[model samples]
Each structure stands twice: as structure tokens, then as C-alpha cells.
Target: MNTTRKLLVLASMTSLVTGCTSLPPDAGFDEVSVNVEQRIANKVHWYTGGEEDAQVRQSIHDRLAQPLTADSAVQIALLNNYNLQAAYADLGISQADLVQAGLLKNPVLEMTRLKPRNGEDASLDIELRFEFLDILLIPLRKKVATQQFAAAKQRVTATVLDHAALVRKAFYEAQTSQHMEDMFREVTSSTEAALEAARRLRKIGNITAGTFDRFQLSHDETRLSLAQSEMSNRASREKLNQLMGLWGEQTQWLIEGGLKPIPFKPIDVNDIEKRAIANSLDLAILKHDIEALAERSGIENVKSIIDDLEAGYAWDRESSGEWSDGPTIELRIPIFDFGHARRARVAAELKQLQDSYYARAIEIRSSARALSDRLQSSRAMVEHYIDNILPLNRRIKDNELLNYNAMQIDVFKLLRAHEKQVASRQLFVQALRDYWLARADLETLLSGRANTVSDMRGPAISMGGGNEGGH
Candidate 1:
């Protein structure tokens, strides 16, 4: 009997020491790295910070090579971003917890000996028993775990959508900065030529000193403006790199050309509202949170403060060569703290959830309405710029240039006309950008198909057929 006891102790110790079990290895490290490298090389540009180069291009293509139209950017974010990847790891941990929650409790092993004061022999006994929660509680625990997992998934999805929207906005802003930089370069060159012409005219007594001074001032201002625009362009590029998860000086920078410019398609508010109701990830996450709250409420209602019930079977042998076998049952009675506070807290949380859902609904509706109105206004502004303002400004600038060349007006008038022309063009670009972004915002709120600029028409996506475009 002593031998058997020693053997059992050794066995338990061994099991405890080696408690952790190994799972099958996932994809091999070299294979995964190769896949990542291949994806980067062939797919999309991956930029984090600094200038763009071949390495960054390979990284982005590997990770984001697939078309991430504004509509699909959210999906890409969830699938590719490091943050979303971390969230997926959390999902695995939660699943493990769920498995534990549904598991049966291991048996308790007990050993004890009772000695008789006047007896020569001592009787030894052993007990081994297992207990499980009532079957009724099983479903409740599962429900709690299920709700938690659902909430986690929803959070990940919402995060993806938010990041995608940010990427689209930043991408467009960077492109705008690039365009402005190009314009500044052209303007500076033009100013330099005008300044040289003014100097020549003044030396030949064809222009006065004031004309030369104004020309020099314009040239200097244009140089300053060019420098400022270049700086801004660099800043915008860095921001895009940050969004693409590029860090350090490891990658190169470049915003690819071929952004399709399209006319804004008018959308009805009623249709948009319906789409928002059906497709909003924010709304879906809120609904999941409410369900999680409901589960927490259930957990509180059934939780026991002190009372517990246990029943199991045991067998033991005594040192005196006698054996005993029977079932054991134990019950704990509550003496104080009967779980009322826990129940109250859970009830309060449920109420809070109710309030939150209503607030979210109201906010979403209000946002949708406001975006719809802005979209209409922006479209009108875009039309006005395209059909009236831009055409008239270009014609006036051309006529002014002809008059200046004919020597009908002084150099100062020509300089003023150049400034006017540049300002008019800038305003036109701003109006067009406003229309594009307003439409993007409207689509974002309404969960429409027109969320990205790329979808305003570009090359078709190879996988997951959907509207693809970047604004």
C-alpha cells in the first residue's frame, strides 16, 4: 500500500511538471517569410517613413498589392495591418479561454490516516473524486464566452473600417500636396523668366526702376512659395508612409499616378439611409456590445456568493487490510453577501447599453443627414467651377497674356494677370477636391459602393469583386 501511494505521488508530480502540451507547428518560418517577401515584391507598395525605394515598393506590393479601393480598404486593413493582426491574436486567446470555460473539473485526490489512541495499528485511507458544475450552468458559461468573442470580433472590424477611412483621406491629401508642389515649381520658373526680362528691359531703358523692383519681388516670393510647397509635399508623403506601417529610413516614397478623375454621381438621401441601416459596421458592433451586456446580466443573476454543491464517488484501502467505497456529497450554505451587488451592477450595465445604443443610432442618423446635404452642395460647387469659373478665368488669362505681348499694358499688369490666373486654378482644384472628399464622406456614412476615388473607374480588381478606388 505504501508502494502504491509513492507511485501515485510520483505520477502526479510528473504530470504537473509537464502540464503544457504542444500544438502542431504552424507554417514554417522560412516559408512564411518567403511568402511575405514574394507578396511585397509582386503585390503593393509598402511605405512607412522617409523616401520611397525598391524595398518599400516591394513591401507594399507584397502586403497591399491587392486592390484596396475605398470600399475594400476596410477589409484590407483588417487582413493586413499589424494592429489588426494583434487583434487576431487576441481572438485566439479568447477562443482558448472559451475552451477552458466548457471544460470539466479534474478530480480531487485526497489522502488521510486516522489513528486510534489505544490501538496498535493505524488505518490509512485514500479518496479520489471529480465534480462538475450543474449542466444548467454549462450553457450560461458558453453564452458568456460567445458574447465576449463576438464583441472582440466586432471591435476588430470597426477598427479596420476606421483605419481604412483614414488611409483614403491621407492618400488624397498627399496627392493634392504633390499637385501643389508641381504648380509651385512651374510658377517659380515663370517668375524667374519674367524677372530676367524685366532686368533686360530696364537696362535698355524700356522699363522703369519700379517695374524691375516689382519683378524682383515677384521672383523672390515665388521662390519662397516653391520651397514651402516642397516642404508640405514631403510632410504629406511621410504621413502616407506612416499609414502604410513604414518606419525608419528603410523604404522609398512615391505616390503612384493614374488617379481617375470622374464626375460626381448624384445619390438620393433615402437610398443612402437605407444602405447605412443595412451595412454600417458601427451599428453592427454596437448591437454585439448590447448582446454582450445582456449576457453579463445573466451571469450576475445566477452567480452564487457562498453556496456550492459537490458530489462525487471515492474508494480507499486502510493499512489494517480493510477497504471502504462510497459516494461523497457536500453543500455550502451562504452566510453573508448573497451576490446582490453583482446582480445590481449587471443590471445597471444593461441599462447603460440600452442608452448607448439609442445614442449611437441618433448620432449615425444625424451624421448621415449632414453628409447628404454636404454632398449635394459640393456637387453643385464642382459643376460651377468646371462649367463657368474655370473656363472664364482661363480665357481672361489668355487675353491678358496676348495684350501684354502686344505691349498694350505694362509688366506690372502682366504680373497681376499671372497671379490671378494661378489663384483661379488653385481655387478650381480646391473645389474639385472638396467635391471628391464630400462624396467619400457621404459614402462612408451611408456605407455605399462609391466610398473610394478608385471606384470612380479604374482597372478591375482580381479578387473579391467589388467597387475599387482610392480617393
Candidate 2:
């Protein structure tokens, strides 16, 4: 192209791009704004209150971390998180769309007048018309919008539940870190005592330098392990706070301990199955999607079809084109544009809905099966660690303590037993964490109520039933 033409073309392109103005970030979802107030209101609860007292902060933290029969973290997330707030706005936008879809198009108005040149007066012509689709398609459009809003609500519920599950997982992880730290500290203390006893024994020519060096190494390693555990705990806390929507340096929380033991109760699988099938957010969302697809199918039925039902009144004016007394009507037929495309679209939508429904069913089944298997395995592991390994290690530690007090064995044996006990306790904690995590996963997968691994007490309970003996 010539330089001038090229310049003109470039300018034209620029104008076209600029003239096609970008919508505001929220322009598309304005209806969501209206629903925000109600969703936000739904989150109000006593548990949503903010912490104030410095001394009681740790206790408050413990309470929040305390395991409940049902997960409250989801409720907290809905009440607190900024991202969820945005989701509420989305719901409002969808609601507004439904309202808009129900409305009809405004009729167009036109007026024309002519003036006589030589001797007479002026006359006027008027006409009014509107798109027929506005009258015919608005009800179908409204149905689609309503379905969309319902789907949005389902999504919001699902998001909150997911957040709650995450909070529980993070809480358990941080607690595990704390437990590991405590175990390492106990190990370090015992090792330190052993090292001191070894030094005295070396002075008396009872123990060798090599043994003392080994004790020193164990002590140092314990310290290193403790430090690493602390770092992990801090990171876990940060993750939990992030999910809770606390930002910046203020995100710090006072996590006291791992989950407190709760009374164990084996959930009735049948009840869970029923509840999940009825209340599961994913299922509800899928159902809403199916409804939406059905609505679209109806619209699709009209898509390839074009109907021309145009009507206009022409006034027969008097001399000089003044207002007329009567009117004449005209109609246009839909000739080339038939409803074939619309029929195809409807067929496609029906197939899409069918496919989605089957896919969702498969997903639900797979998720439930995986979760059940994991929960069973984890519960068995926890039982083995707590019932068999933990008590055996504790007895060994007690025996070693007795030997040391009697001067039958040196402090080194005592330290070794202490380390063993700490290791066993750490393993037990891990088992418990796994059990709880598995339960949480299973609950989410089945859309069932969150089953607590611990009650209000800070000890592990047998999953089968409470033993009639003391711990």
C-alpha cells in the first residue's frame, strides 16, 4: 500500500480498537453485587467474633483449632475470606441477569412531516415497531438466567466446603509440627543428661570417650530436628492464616497444640450415603447445570429458525401530509432463515446435559470409593501405633528410669530409652494426623458431615469404642 494509505489504515485500526471500549472488571457481573448483602449476612455467628484479649488469645486459638464433630472451618471461611466475598458478588450478578432476561424490548418510534411549498399546510406520519424475538424468547432467557443463579449458589457452597477442609488439614499439619518439636525437645533434654553423666563416668574411668562423643552427636541432632520442626510449624500456620484471609504481618495466630481427642463414634455409612446424595454441593451444581442445559435446549430449538412477523401501521394523511384517520398493516414472512439451526442446537444441548450427568455420577462414585479405602487404612495404622507401639515404648522408658535410679544401668541407657519413647510418641502423632486427614478427605468426597478424630480432650481415643480402662 502507499504510505498515505498505510497511515490511514493504521489510524483506522487504532480507532477501531480504541472505540471498542473495554468493559470495567465488574461490568459483566453487576448482578452479583445485589446478592452479596444476603450471603454476607448468612455468615454471621458467635464463632465469627474477633479475638481481643492478649492472655486469652492462645486459648481462643485452641478453641478454634479444637476438633468438633462437624467442621466449622468452612463457616469461618465463608464469613471471613475476601475471595468468597467476590463469589457472593457473582451470585448477585447472576440474579440481576435473570431479572433482565424477563424484560421486553422497548418499541421504536418514528415521525415524519412535510411542508407544502405553494398554498397549503403541513402533514405528519408516525410509525412504531419492535423485535418479535423480545416477546417470544424472553421467558426462555429468564429460565436460563434463573438456572445460572442456582448454579452459582451451588458453586459458592462447594467453595466454602473446600476451604473448610483445607483449614482442617492445615490445622492438623501445624499441630503435627508442634508435636514433633516437643518430641525432639524431650529427646534433647534426655541426651543432655546422658552426656553429663558420661562426662562424669569418663572422669572416673568407667565410660569411654567414644560413647560420650556419640551422646553429644545425638544431642546436636535433636536440636537440629527441633529447629526444622519449628520452621515447618511456622509455615503451616502461615498457610492456615492465608486460607482464612488474614493478610500481611497480622496473619500470625496462637496455635497451642494438636487436635484434642474426641470420643470416637463410627459413622453409619448408610446415613452418610443418604446425606451426601441429598446435600452434596457438587451434585447440586451438576443438577443445576442439567437444568440450564435443558433451558438452552429450548432456546436452541429456536436458533436456526428465523420468524419474520413484522407489522407496521401507515397513516393515510390529509392534504399537506397532516394526521390520518385510519391505518394499514403489512407483514413479512421468514423465507430463507428457517429453524433448522435451532433444532440442531437443541439436540446438541440435550446430548451435552446427558453426558455431564453421567460424568458427575462417575466422579462421585470414584471419590467415595477412594476416600473409604484411605480412611480404613489410616484408622488401622493409628490403632497399631497407639495400642501396640506407643505403650510398649512407654514401658521401656519407665524400666530404664527404674534401672538408672537403682544405679543398675548408666544414664546412657536412660537417655536411649527416652529417645525411643519420644520417637514412638512422634509416630503415634503421625498416625493420628493421617487418620484425621483421611476422615476429612472422605467427608469431603462423600459430601458428608466432617467426622471428628478428636473430641474436646487432648488424647487419642480408640475408633471402635471407649475401653473400660484408664490410659
Candidate 3:
């Protein structure tokens, strides 16, 4: 073809493809929503401060209007948490990459003029060059990018589900601490009043100084326990605040409800092992990565042997008014490198991902079983505190009160019974908290993500059960 015709065709190609932009409207965000739909139905918002973003802000405000339950907390986090919004940027970047992958490299043009030795009309040359290989590889590049985009969406979904679980954990922690604080306050008040009675009894010679001192000690310990509970309540409140992305006045939000009672029915774990493995987001991401690597390996295999194979149109005008125009070709011969090193690198990475996938599956199965055991064990602890310990303490408290009223026992003995009952209640609060925490962790592992192995143990706090015979 003539130089002018070739130039016109290349220009036309660039324009046509320019209008063929491949960006998705919301860039696979809806797909991410679908991925996490099972875990949360809350709509996520990327806060870019437009009209839609304004609507999202209003939605968040409405959800945060009341005291937060677990669902509302997750909803607000999905819409308003800055980190979750930041996570959406991965989708944006990957979509941009996909768009870039489908596009051809911009055609390159070169022009020059040179006078011959005889000072003839300056010889003119013009060439338009582009990678034909890029045209052949567009589909492969898109395949690779599509897989990477899939991995990105899975990762974001995993992040969303994990954050929801974490918020649930934080909510329970906050509620448990609040309950603990209230219970300890009552214990402190009862102990303080009993101490006052003990002073009177000792002054009247109804009790020894040692007995009065013991009551004083009990009151002091109750005060200490109350203080510790107050600290825990404040700490847990701050953690929930952080997770919910609240600050300033927003930090004053309250939890709506308390933890539920432990159920006697155990959770069914018959297929949980296989289910966790199947639903694992980490495993899904690895599969995408491996597929992406496979596509990349195909590209590298070609590129390693022939890194650059560019073809173009060349035009020249000589001094004698004669013009020459023809096609031009370019290739980079691989003299030192035979693609062995690149093939080895791709093979190693593919194998690494394969091994990681298997390892993750095994780890997930074991964690599922361990967390299942932890959940049942937590229920048992709560039941034990209620059935074996608290009821017995309540009976002891009733008998001691009757004896004291009949003047058959000292006030100190009656105070000891009251302390034991309060101690049982304290243990019950701890067991209840641990039970809920355990359940949250187990549920998260089953659905949130695959890489995590949560610690089954609860935090070591003051067990504050007065077993001092009197305490």
C-alpha cells in the first residue's frame, strides 16, 4: 500500500479503538457485593463524595441513628468504614488493569530529513511502527487480567466478611464488659453495706476483730474488681469504636442488646470441614492466581524467544523526485537467552501457589474441627457455672440468711454466703462472654476467609470469684 494510505488506515485504527474503552461502569463492585451476599446483605459505598456518595452518607446516618446491634454495626462499617472503602480501590486498580490489557499499544511514528552529499532535495523518510505481537497477545493479556480481577474481588469479599466477624466479636466484648461492670457494682454495694454491719456487730461483741477485718477485706476486694471491670469496659468500647470508624461524639454510641443465652443444642459440624474448604476465599484467590500465572507463562514463552517483533510502513523520497514506499519488519534475536530462565521462574511460581493451595486446604480443615470443639466446650463452661456452681451458692445463701435471722450464726457467716453467690455470678459472666466469643470465631472461620486461624482461648481477665469460704 502507498505511504499516505497506510498512514490513513493506522490513524483510523487508533481512533476506532480509542472509543472502544473497556472500563466497567462500577468496575466489578457489584460482583464483590454478590460475593459477600451470603455473609452480609449490606450495601457498600465507595466514598468519592458525589451524589451517590451523599446518599450513602445519609444511609449510614440512618443506620447509626440507634444503638448498634451486630447487624447494624456491620452495615455501618460496610457503608462508612474508611478501610473497607479503601479496600474497594483494589477493584478499581484491577479493573483499570483489565482495561489496559485489552488495549493496543499506541502506534509510534518517526520522521526525518537529510541532505545527500550532492545537496539534492533533502532526502525524506517517515515510518510508523507498532507491535504486531501485541495484537496477537491481546486476548491472552485480557485472560490474565480477568483472572487477576477475579482474585481481587475475592480478596475484597474476604476482607468484608472478616471485618463483619470482627465487629461482631468487638460488639460482644463491649456488651460483656458492660454486664460485668454492672454485676460488680452490685457486689461492691452489697459488700460495703455488709462491712458496715460487721463494724456494729464487732463493737457489740457479737463478732471478733478478725471477723470484722475479713469483712473489710472483702469490701476492699470488691472495690478493686469493680475498678478492673470499669477499665475493661472502656477498653472494649474503644476497640468497637475503632472498628466502626467512629470518633469524637460518634464514639458515644451504645450497644443495643446483650449476649444471648447458651443453647443446649450443639452446632452440627458433620460437613463443616469440607464446607469451610469449599467456601474458602483464600483458596479461590490461589486458583485465580494459578490460572493467571498459566496465562502469563504462555506470554513469557513467546516473549523470551522473540522479545520485540515490530512491523511498520516505511516511506522515502530521494533527490530525483522518485518516491519509494514499502512495508518494514523488525525482530530482536535472542542470542544469549533461550527462555530457559523465564520458563523456570514461571514454573517455580506456579508450583509455589499449588503447594500453598493444598496447605491452606488442610489448615482450614483442622481449624474447622478445632473451632467446633471450642464452641461446644464454651457452652459446657456456661452450663457448668449455671447448674453446678451458681444454684448451689444460691441455696447456701438462703440457708445462711435463715440461720442469721434466727441468731444461730454470726453476721460474718451470712456475709460469706452472699459473697459466694456473687462470685458464682461473676464466673457465669466470664463463661458467657467466652462462649459468645468462641462462637463468633468459629462462624468467621467458616465463612469469612481461609487464611486465618483464630486463637480459641478467651482473654485472661480477673476470674473474681470469691471462694474464700467467706469470699
lDDT of 1 by residue, 279-378 (tens): 6555565566566556655655555542355665555656566776666777666667677776676667667666765765666666677788887887
Better TM-score candidate (1, 2): 1
lDDT per prediction?
Answer: 0.57, 0.59, 0.78
59 in model 3: Cα distance from truth in Å? Answer: 4.1
**TM-score for all predictions?**
0.74, 0.73, 0.90
Best by lDDT: 3
Candidate 3: tens digits of C-alpha lDDT, residues 152-237: 88888888888888888888888888888888898898898899998888889988989889889989998999999999999999
TM-score rank order? 3, 1, 2
Better of 2 and 3 by TM-score: 3
> Candidate 3 local accuracy as lDDT?
0.78
What total of clashing residue pairs does each candidate reach? 22, 17, 1
The residue-level lDDT of candidate 2 at 247 comes to 62
Task: Name the Cα RMSD for model 3.
Answer: 11.1
Q: Candidate 1 or 2, higher lDDT?
A: 2
